[model samples]
Target: MYKETLSSGIIIVPMQQEHAEQLEALQRIVFPNLAEEELLHADQYKKHVELFPEGQFVALDGDKVIAATSSIRYHFNLNDNEHHTFFEIMGGGWFTTHEPNGEWLYGMDVSVHPDYRSKGIARALYRARQYTCKQLGLKGQMTVGMLNGYAAVSDQMNIDEYYKKVKNHELFDPTVSVQEKVGFEIVGLMKDYLNDPTCGNAGAVIVLDAGKAI
Candidate 1:
């Protein structure tokens, strides 16, 4: 299992069956408004560990799961900007679409507890994801970033304007901004991507090139 201790004193480790309940609770806290169908449960987490143990990770504070991320391997064509819903991509949150020999690592979920925000947990988990990508010789990491901050200013602007503002640094998004700061690059905008009213069901397709030093 992959393991590391961050300077912040948080430990990053591979996900296991024992972590499912904590992870499920963390998910609810991190994404309170996430679509019902897209929410994950303990059984799905166990299924993920059974399917791809190395691709799943959790950040711990003395055995407490403060953050977690789940990923699945897939053959991703960088040029393909086709739209896909969160449920479809995540295989109903069970990561049932994993491809053992796929070309890229697709991130299904990333969650950091509210109390642990800005303490480097998310970045650490992201680094762990990159480590797994390099270890598996995958091309890179890919994910649809949530526009978590959009809800606050949603009444003032449409998603397109909000996206442009976020991209230009005129605004900061809890998800997209953090992902960009940690090395992911926006490739395209995904509309109607999930049942997130806060983000107008929008998502940003982000990619990290593991072929390069990340």
Candidate 2:
């Protein structure tokens, strides 16, 4: 497992391939609506293991992986409508080639073992992502789901408006909240993004400017 201490001197590290199953199980418990096919697939874990093993930071209370968080970076391609004057004034950009290497981090899969909850483990893992982003020279971070988003078919063929009624829909996952607390901001919403029956509503998209990294 990869490991390090935070500015507050807490130990944290990366989850190993061996811990992938546990992480998936934990994520399912926390985010039951997430599609099993997409979120818990073995290949998905393998990709993370290969591409972001170190980005998948875990907290160890001994030899066990107690909590975990990971990130994936890719180019964001912004559509024309997003180029409005107000959007640019507010720095509304992600789907574009502007970022050096055309990169943005998809922060995902944060989970804390029951015994480790309330111990600030999530905060540490989040700090680790920020640290990695800074070290890699990334420009920003993004996440899915915020408001009025509902699950639709893979192609968003049909969607339900019930998403506006889902409780806690605006609340960020622990990882997302950490990103926001450190200056990440909500950029846009992905309507009917995920069609999986498991995920309650479509996901929201959030962004954190690289300049805000601590």
- The TM-scores of all predictions, comma-separated, are 0.95, 0.64
lDDT value for candidate 1? 0.89
- Model 1: runs farther than 4 Å from truth? 212-214
Candidate 1 TM-score over all chains jointly:
0.95
Q: What is residue 188's positional error in candidate 1, in angstroms?
A: 0.4
Error at 142, model 2, angstroms: 1.3
Root-mean-square deviation of Cα positions for candidate 2 versus the true structure, in angstroms: 8.4
Give a tens-digit lDDT track for model 2, residues 52-117.
554567776666656777666656643411322212211221212122343766665466776666
Q: Write the per-residue lDDT of candidate 1 for residues 1-214, one digit (tens) a residue.
A: 6899988889999998999999888888888888778899998999999999889999889989999999999988779977789998889887878999988999988888989898888888888999998898889899999888898998899999999888888999988998999889988889999998988899888999996554
- Best by TM-score, which number? 1
CA lDDT for candidate 2: 0.53
